[model samples]
Target: MAQRLQSISAVTVSGALVIVLLLTLTFGTLGAVAFRADSLSGLSTRDWAAVRFTVVQAFLSALLSVILAIPVARALARRQFWGRSVLVTLLGAPFILPVIVAVLGLLSVFGRNGLLSQALGFAGLEPVSIYGAHGVVLAHVFFNLPLATRLILQGWLAIPAERFRLAASLGFGARDILRHLEWPMLLAVVPGAFMVIFLICTTSFAVALALGGGPKATTIELAIYQAFRFDFNLSKAALLALAQFGLCAIAAVISLWVSIPAGQGAGLDRVVARRDGSRILDFTVLLLVTLFLITPLGVIAVKGLGSVLSLPASTYGAAGRSVCVALASALLTIALTLPLALLAQRVSKLIEGVGYLSIAASPLVIGTGLFILVYRWADPVVLALPITILVNAAMSLPFALRAIAPALAEVERDYGRLSDSLGLTGMARMRLVILPRLRRPLGFGAGLAAALSMGDLGVIALFADPDSATLPLAMYRLMTAYRMDDAHGAALLLLSLSLLLFWVFDRGGRVNADI
Candidate 1:
């Protein structure tokens, strides 16, 4: 009974994803048909500038993320301190956190009147510009560094304990051991991490749109938004969207090629014979990562606290809307993602790859495709909120799959035959047998989906009207209007909401169902 329901849910989830992909592809095909022949002729100097800036920012963001990850990955690999697992889990949160929320936290710390500014004021030093290209880079690093750190750490963990034991037994020096074991792990993970960060930065609209001070800082995604929303230049927006797609598609292909297999055993506990390394190098690495990871957050918390009372009533309303949107998106994302995870588990590897496609594609790209589709059918697009929820759910699919797949696999491996023998088949099996056993993964996936949707500004930016703004979108408006106080308050609220949702969902997932 349970098996039968699982099968039905799995098929339904897979079908939903297929319908979405088809819609997106259909839009892309129409876009190509209408715009491809004329895109070159319509390209402007400003479009060229935006394209160049986008590429440069993404490349630099990727480079910095992977380079900075080296040490944190090393520390995480070598040390097993108190709260280490908690810290590792926290590192993964940024991947799910909305870009706008991170940007808010970043601004509260790094902005002109941010905490840093106040601290530097005492010494008569000016606060650095946290707008334009610089802000985008900082925000990108904040989000990507932790992700790269985790990925590289996974690679380090994959090295067999026997190899480390042999090295220790042979009295291998730190340099020799690193050259043989550490370097290999680093090399394998770095390129793929870089590519992921690069793809993310490439499609960034909120960060660029909010922080981009002028013509100088525009990214391609921002260009598309401006062309469509502000200027009402559909043809040009369509043209730029294609350009954005081409660049992202190439980057995605390269990223997928270099990506390491998403195996279940990678994050599991492993034993490695410990060896002494240069204390100086270890300390330096730890310090750099700590400063990079925690400082901005600290900055935001302090500054946000100072300005919290000054926030406007409208900001509060926006916060409420954001909460509703995040919650709805999270729920929708989990409901949709469950079946996709099951499909990935049950279907051929090739079809499983289709389930993983959301990672390689950005939210802006997906949203663009949807926009084209909607504009075809409706003049004003009445279903913006539902559409935003749907798109956010789809965007959250990769993270949802990553969180759920391993646990599902583990459950299947251990209980497949037992369940079958017990005559567990459809919905009965899922409710009675599978759900109880898979609570942890389900909760984790739910938390991730909620957190990611909370932090997201991509689809919301496209769909939100002035009266229908989510927190992230409202915060962007504040920043652009130079309403620093309001922006700070909203930023703090968004950050708290995202973290709280993540924590609740994560804890919820841990609840036992009496297996």
Candidate 2:
């Protein structure tokens, strides 16, 4: 028995070390660099303006997304029609869409000569420019609306059918329903949804970089990049990183606090015997929301079909590099998650929170810390790809753990005693028992990680030179150069890769999966 336990000591210790090292780098290194500059005392008017803009835009974006989502989500929740599932799936598309690609799609529909502007121009109105604060908020809403909708939708779906049936029995009308059941759910759900979207917006860089021009609209994430890349002002960059991290930390606390679960009693999954309010109103909301979300992507697809195949060699090169990064990041996600999950089973589960640290520290903030550390030893430019790969993996770790850990716990619960009784342990148990059962979740998680890495435009933008550029960065370069066609082509290619990798990895080898 002693020998059996000792067999995995080294591996266990290694997992602990990994968590320690992650914590040290995440906060410890940043803490040291943050105080190195008088940046805390030296924040300029522009710096404070960036901070203000960051919070204000994020607040507005979150508020608007939630407000718009309420009607849309309620409609979807009560009405189950043909193609409803497909529509729900489409809502998730923006999340995985590359930031730069989504920005292009938004531009296609809302740019100065875009569909909206063109329509207005044909009606003898002015062409509206999407290159400022309005554009930034518009882009943030486009990306986050679905997220807010889905979050609220889940809240709606959580209401047991029995409750609605009882409400109908009591002769509750729309307003009555709003007061009794709907308001309670909204009270419980909306704060968390708003905070999540706000956190995401506060950390937005690509949207701001592409649309938010001028000092008045700069976000802390973008300011970090400008200070780091253009000004070569490490002090300013570190300070901005500090600010962004603090912002995220406060938002995280609020999300956790405000996200208290109101008890919705369990049900028999029966259908509700209640009327969905105003079919015309609900249908109109669905139609407009669908078109609003889908039209821009459709424009990108139609435009890119003409050029995706004949894109420049550099486009394909960047695509290949992104693929490599995605694959590497996925692999690393697996490596990190499996060990940490096992350590949790054997030790304490609180350690798993280390995986989530990446979320609170935006990729740029992490890159900023890494830069501070690397600058002391080696040129960060030389280490760009590696750093991007590492950050992508770390960022994906939380999602991977969410996928893998639960399955692992269940597997261990069902099989742990048997494996031990049979003298199965370590690699043998993993190969013969654990890995087989985890195939589905592993596939899904790795696919998600790969998809995210493929579409990522955050950390790489902070670190990469032309030679080290990922596809998203390359597309941004094209957009900046006014090569719209090439940019769309690259966007198409990137969009394809992101979706394909996710589909392949998610569906890969799940044929008769053990679970």
Query: TM-score of predicted model 1?
Result: 0.88
lDDT of 1 by residue, 61-87 (tens): 889988888878877777656777877
Report the C-alpha lDDT of model 2 over 1-515, residue by residue, as the tens digit.
Answer: 76477647845886787797678667865786586556487778899999999999999999999999999999998887899999999999898888898899989998986899999998999988888888999999999999999999999999999988888888888899888899999999999999999999998889999999688889898888898889988898888888898999999889878996857879888877457489889989999999998998999999999989989898899999999999999998888888888888777788777877877878888888887787878988889888888888888888889998899899989999998999987778889999999999899889989999998888888778898899999999999999999989999999999999999988984867956
Off by over 4 Å in 1: 1-37, 115-127, 260-270, 306-310, 376-381
Model 2 stretches astray by more than 4 angstroms: 7-11
Which candidate has the highest lDDT of all? 2
lDDT of 2 at 410: 95
For each candidate in turn, the TM-score is 0.88, 0.97
Best by TM-score: 2
